[model samples]
Each structure stands twice: as structure tokens, then as C-alpha cells.
Target: MKNLKLIVFALLLTFCTTSINAQTADEIITKYIKNIGGAEKLKALKGIKMNMVTNYGGMELPVEMVQLAGGKQYVKLNMQGKEITQMASDGKTLWSTNFMTMSPEKSDAENTENALQSNADFPDAMLDYKAKGYTAEFVGKETKEGTECLKVKFTKKPIKVDGVQTDDVSYYYFETENFLPIATEIEIKAGPMKGKKSNSTMSDYQEVEGIFFPFAINMGGQDLKIKKITLNPVINEKDFAFPAIAAVTAEPAKK
Candidate 1:
């Protein structure tokens, strides 16, 4: 009888702990969303355009990024009078410019699909995450950059990697005092950085038309300083389309 009672007690303890963790996660997310201009304002956002700059090899490169609702986005970099499309997705197709070839290349079907699914969480993934079939767990507290933070593990629908379904997960660290997400860590699943952790930190948040944005972002070791942010910017679909390659004109035999 005592053994059964202990078993029941253990089960109850586990349930309570889980309930508390889930509640904490939701509360944190709710506070964060409210801090970042509320849910309605965020949902009403049509698109955003950012003018930024990053230093590469002691050279300052101008960067422009545009992201629209429903998964349309692109990032461009200007270097030495040449503009390069770093990456882009028109909500259906994924593509990027090849530096060596200076030509656009489309991503494989699987990667394109994965990108669309991931970008669908735009504006903010934690907003109505449950409805999007995502889960957020309060994973406890940690210190980042000398500030105490509450860590949350966010998991989304699986994405295909090399034709195999893989877990899509990221960890966000929210400042304990302000509830602002200060850092994010995600695992690199492909390329030379496969199996390594990619870390990004945000700071110097400023408001634009009542919505807060991080003006300074550090991804890996590269820093992007946002100069301006335009909300609801008009976008042209043609900008996201893959450029057509000009056909070579056949020359008549030299007379």
C-alpha cells in the first residue's frame, strides 16, 4: 500500500511540474509579445524593410533586407559597386546569387519547401504558436552576456534535410527583467557548419511607429547595424523572381 501511494505521489509531482513549466512558457511569451507592441499590431504588419551595414574584412558593406507577410523575403549586399542577392524566397521558390558565377541558382525542391514553412512563422513565431502546431517549453534560467534570462525551447514542424525529416528547434533567451529576447541559438543542419551551433544576439532596440526592433544584431561574429526600418513598404513581386539569363547571340561567320 505504501509503495502504491509513493507511486501515485510521484505521478502527481510530475504532472504539477509539467503544468507549471507550460504555464510559465506561455506567460513569458505573452509578456514578450506585449512588450514588442502587442499581437494585433504585429499581425497587422504587412512588411518591413531594413537598411543595414556590416563590416567585412574592414570594409563596410551596405545591406538591404525586405520581408513581407506570407513568407516573401530577400537580403542584398552591396560591395564595390556590385550588388549581390544573398538569398531570397518568393513564398514558393528559394534562390540565391552565386558569387563566382554572378548568376541566380534555385534551391532544391525540398529546401524551398522547408524555407517556406519556416518563414511562415514570420513577424514573430511565438505569437499564436500553439495554433501553428508549435510547442514552447520553459527550459529554465540561464545567464547570457551577464544578464539573467529565462530560456525557452521552441519547436516547430519537422523540416526535411537531405530527404530525411528532421526536428526544427531553436532556443531563445529572454531577459528576465524586460522579457526581450536577447539571444537565439540554433543548430546548423547543413553545409560546412553542419552539427555546429549558430548563435545570434540582439541589442539596442529602437521603436519605429510604435513597434520595437533590434537595431543591432550579431550573427556568429558578423555585426549588422540597422540604419533605418520602414514598415509596410510596397514590394514588387518581380523583385523576388529569378532573373532570366540572356541568350548568347550567334555571330555570322566572319567575312
Candidate 2:
């Protein structure tokens, strides 16, 4: 009788363990998308305008960013009542304003391409990933800082420059309990930080338009705190155009 009881307990434990590890990559991604919002809602998402307070070296700086569905984005940082830095893209061309000159110049070709490739997608990268020529693989579960997380890796389609390889990859860590990404890892392939890994932790998830979004992200010592987020805000082409006024003024575009 005692031996029978032990065998039954072992079988039950194995079943539970298998159940916990049974989630496939697609299933995990689907659950993650559903937990935040459904695929249909995410597909209909057109644009977003967000106000962020960035912490840098003990100083808090306010930054306003606008992003459209097809990859156009603009970011403005105000400091000392001045338009200190600005970056904008028109889906194809990328330009930026120098801090001192405030003159618009074409950004680096590699950086521009990277931004264009990454920005033209869902706020959550997992949405329609397969359709976007990307593939994801299940890497099983791991514990992060006392939290059990589902680890997954997604491979970006290979990038090339004059027949040279420049493809990059990204990793995501989603808390098993909520199916929300709490952290991400990436390695820089270009620019000054080439081949260096960067890890960011996300928390403070708040709901916006039936979707959950991380309102806070800590990367190294810098923190991005979202103050406001307006979906489908009306954005004029000029907002992302070069040669703008000395000052930029914007209000949420009427839905």
C-alpha cells in the first residue's frame, strides 16, 4: 500500500511538470498577445502619441514621441525651454536635428535602415511576426530574479550590406503568470556599441485602449516613464518633416 501511494505521487508530479512545459512558441506568443489585447485590436492600431519622462544622470527630461502605422516616427526632447534634439522619419528618409546647429541632416545609413525595419510593426513585436518574415522559437522556462519566466527567441530576417551579413537577433522574457514581457535582450550590430548586449526591464504595465503596455522601462541606469499615451492621434506629415519651426507644438489629434 505505501509503495502504491509513492508511485501515484510520482506520476502526478510528472504530469504536472509536463503540463507546465507543454506550451509551444506559437501558443505562448498567442497567449501573450491575448493577455495584452487581441490580435484584431492590435491589427487595427494605426498610430500612437506618448509623453515620456526620461531619467538621465539624476535629471528628468520630458520627451514626446509620435509613431505611425507604416514606420514614420518623430521624437522631440525639450530642455531648458529649447528644442534640444529631434529625430524624424518619413517612412523612407531619416533625418535629425543637431543640438547646437539644430540643422537637419541625413542620419547614418545603417541606423536609418535599422529604425525603418524595426519601427514599421506592432507596438508588440510578436503580433503578426510570422507574416513579417520573422520566426520565433520556444526556449523553455527559466527563473529571473525570483520570477518564473518563459524564454523565447525570435530571429530577424538576414540583413546584408553589399553582400555582407548584418543580421541581428532579439530575446524576450515573459512572466509565466501574466504572459507579459518583463525584460528583453539585444546585441548591437552596428554603430559605436557594435556587438554589445543590452538588457532592459519593463514593469508598471497600464492599460491603454484595451491593451496592456509597459509604462516603465529601465535600461542600465536610464529609465523611461510614460506619462501619457494617446492612440491613433492625428499627426500631420510636417510633424515628421524636416525644416520645422524653431519650436514644436502639438495636441492629440482628434480620433
Candidate 3:
């Protein structure tokens, strides 16, 4: 009977451990959602509009960035009161323009694939991720820069854009105490740095419209500081149009 008890106890312990792990994952995600101001508030979020000052070489440019709920993005750089460069994505296609080119061009096969893996949802892409065809796994706790973090391995739904399949995999480390994302590791699939990993750490979080957002973001050597945030502002589709098309549509009649 002692042997039987031991087997039963082992089974019970196994079940408990599994249950605890599952609960830990669930609670982390749930609390994270709540701490960021509930799921419905985030789901109804339309977009985020922010302005920042970026310095390239000796020129300081004012960058206006707008992000939509569907993953579309519009960014315009103003230099000396004139627009110089602009890029936009309509959640389907990504296009850009440079001051030298002066023409908005569609992304090539390589860039198109990169844009495909971009988060096209509001707030955290991992929120309600199962419904969006992605899966996230809890990787337990780890220390980052001397701070304990709950590491989670997150994957994007494998996508094929333009016959190219991107490795849609990344990992996010959330603060164990607050559950806010502290860092991310993503693989660079193309370009000179192809097949390498890039790490980005997020901090300086600010709350906007009941949601916590990282106001200061740093990746690689690029530093982005949010100067302003407009939540759910009325945005015109024309704002996202390629400047060439937008310019032609805005011209006065040549009577």
C-alpha cells in the first residue's frame, strides 16, 4: 500500500505543477492586459499619433508618426518647415519616398516580407493572440540587466508575402513585477545584418487614455522619444497616401 501511495502522490504532484505553470502564464497575460487598461479599451483603440525630433548628421528633423489599429503606419519628416521624406503602410502594402527620389515607391520582395511580419494590431499583438493565429509560451523567469523578468517566447503566424516565407519568431521579456514589456529579441531575416539577432529595450512608459505606452524607445543606435500622443484622432485616408498622389489630388484647378 505504501508503493501505491507513492505513485498516487507522484501523479498529484505532477498535476499540480502543470496546473501552476498554466496558471502562471494565464495570470501574467491577464494582468498585463488589465494593467494596460483593460482589453476592450485597447481593442477599440484607433491609433497613436506622436511627434519626435530626430537628428541625422547635423540636420534636425521633426518626425510625425501615426500608427493605426490595423498596423498601417504613416511617417513624415519635416526639415526646415518642408516635408522631405515620407513612408506609409496601408496594412496591405508598404511604400516610401526619399527627398532624393521624390517619388513614392512600393517595397520590393525583401522589404514586403519584412513589412508582413509587422504587428498589425492595436496595443500588444500577443493580446488575444490565439484568435489571431499566433501562439505564446511562457519561458519562466530570467534576469536582464540585473532585473528579474518573466521571459516569454512569442511567435507570429507564419506568413508568406510575395512567395517569401518570413521566420515570424520573436521573444518578449516582461517585468516580473509589472508585467510590462521590458525588452524584445527579434531575428533580422534580410539585409547586411541578415540572420542576426537584434535586441531592443523599452522603458520610460507613460499612460495615455488609460493605457500604458512606451514614450521612449531605443533600438540599435536609434533613439525615439515621443513628444506628443493623439489617441483616436480623426485621420483621413489621404494622409496615408503616397505624397505624389496626395500632392496631385490637392492641386488647384489650372483654369
Candidate 4:
């Protein structure tokens, strides 16, 4: 009787180990994709454009985003009547301009650093996380916004940005039952806002061209708040054009 019990216990332990190992990187990634929509639907996307309105401390600002299939991206912001732009063509080369400060800058060490950090908010990048050489793992489960979710972390492989090489970690909380990402948190790498933690909450998902997009996003950190967001607005490539200038700089305006 004692020998039989030992055999049974060993069998159960082996079964549990096998089950855990069966959860591969591909399987984990596929689950995330299916939870959103599906691989087929996501692959069908060619481009996306969206408009966002954010209110922070009683101030309203407008932002526009555009993304292409091959990891190219663009962002334009109109804050208090000042326009700023950033764009990336191959994930390495970046260009930006700040009409708000009347400064035009080419992609350099600092500009590239800022773009790499900002790319986290792009929806297209989220969908292609695996293909971009990013590693994702199931970090267990938690509750967010009254919904139970699986916590996942995306760690980017070290790469050169703005002439500097760095790695970043981003945490995402995905609704366990639905697999939709609800919240994201990232640490700033290099900037005046460096060393500060930033967060964004997603809501109001709507389907555009067979893919779902978060029409509302609330981002806040460093006493700055992005209070509202809009999606699927008309934008042209010319809007991301950078003006001829020496370097980019951010300075506090006089009061």
C-alpha cells in the first residue's frame, strides 16, 4: 500500500510540470492576439490615424497619431495652440519639430531617445510586440478597474536610439477573461522627465477597419495629465514633416 501511494504522487507531480512547460512563448503570444481580435484581422491593417484630446489641470490639448505596417509611426500635438511633431521611418531614424518653441531639430542622440520611449503608446506596436523582438511573459494575475486580469510585461531588447543604447520595461494589465490591455506603466529613460514613472489607462474600444482601437486614453505623470483621447481622425503625411533647424530643446517658458 505504501509503494502504491508513492507512485501515485510521482505521477501527479510529473503531470503538473508537463502542463506548465507546455505554455510556450508562441502560445502565450497567440492568446494575447486572440483576446484582442485575431491574427487575421490584425494582419489586414495597413494604416491607422486617430485624434486625441487630453485635459490636464483644467487645460485641454489635442494630439494626433499615425502608424504604418512596418513599424513606422508619427505623432503631432497641438498644446495650447503650439504644434509639435515626431516621426520614425525604420524604428531607427527619427525626425521631430516643435513649432510651439519655434525650433526644428533633426534626429540625433536625444531625439531618438525620446521617440523610442514614446513609441510604447502606438497601438500597432502593441499588436506586433512579438515580431519586434520584444519578450512577453505571463507575470501572474491581478485585478484592475474592477476586472480580473493577467499581468504581462514587455521588455525591449537593447537597441541604439539617438546614438545611445538602452533597454526599457513596460508593464501591462490585461483583462484575464477578455485579454484586452487595460493599463500600462513605463519608466522614463532620458529626458527632463527622466526617472519619473508614467501611466496610461485604456477604455472605449471601437473597431476600425476590422481592428479594435482604444478611443480614450488617460495618461498622467510628473504632474502632467492627458485627460481625454479620440480616435480615427483624418491626417496626412505632410503633417509629420520636420522643419530645418539645428537642434531640439525644451525650455520652461516665462511666466
Best by lDDT: 1
Tens digits of per-residue lDDT for model 3 on 100-194?
Answer: 86777887766665664564655568678778887666778989757799887778766553467664888788897789888888887656887
Distance from true location, Cα of 32 in model 2, Å = 0.7
Model 4: per-residue Cα lDDT over 1-255, one tens digit each: 999999999999988755653354345556767766787776665556666666546777677667655445777778678666744344555776655655655677666655655564355455566677777765677887788876777777665545677776888887766667888888877668888888878877766555566766667732223333333344455545454446779898999
| Model 2 ranges off by over 4 Å | 1-23, 160-163, 244-255
Best by TM-score: 1
lDDT winner between candidates 1 and 2: 1
Worst 10-residue lDDT window for candidate 2 reads 159-168
Worst 10-residue stretch by lDDT in candidate 1? 236-245
Q: Every model's Cα RMSD, please?
A: 1.3, 10.4, 5.5, 8.0
Candidate scoring better on TM-score of 1 and 4: 1
Rank ordering of all candidates by TM-score, starting from the highest: 1, 2, 3, 4
Which regions of candidate 3 fall more than 4 Å away from where they truly are?
1-23, 113-119, 244-255
Cα shift from native, residue 184, model 2 (Å): 0.3
* Each prediction's TM-score versus the true structure: 0.96, 0.81, 0.80, 0.67
Error of 3 at 65 (Å): 1.3
Model 4 root mean square deviation, Cα atoms: 8.0
Regions of model 1 farther than 4 Å from truth = 249-255
lDDT of 2 at 158: 65
State the C-alpha lDDT per candidate: 0.93, 0.81, 0.77, 0.64
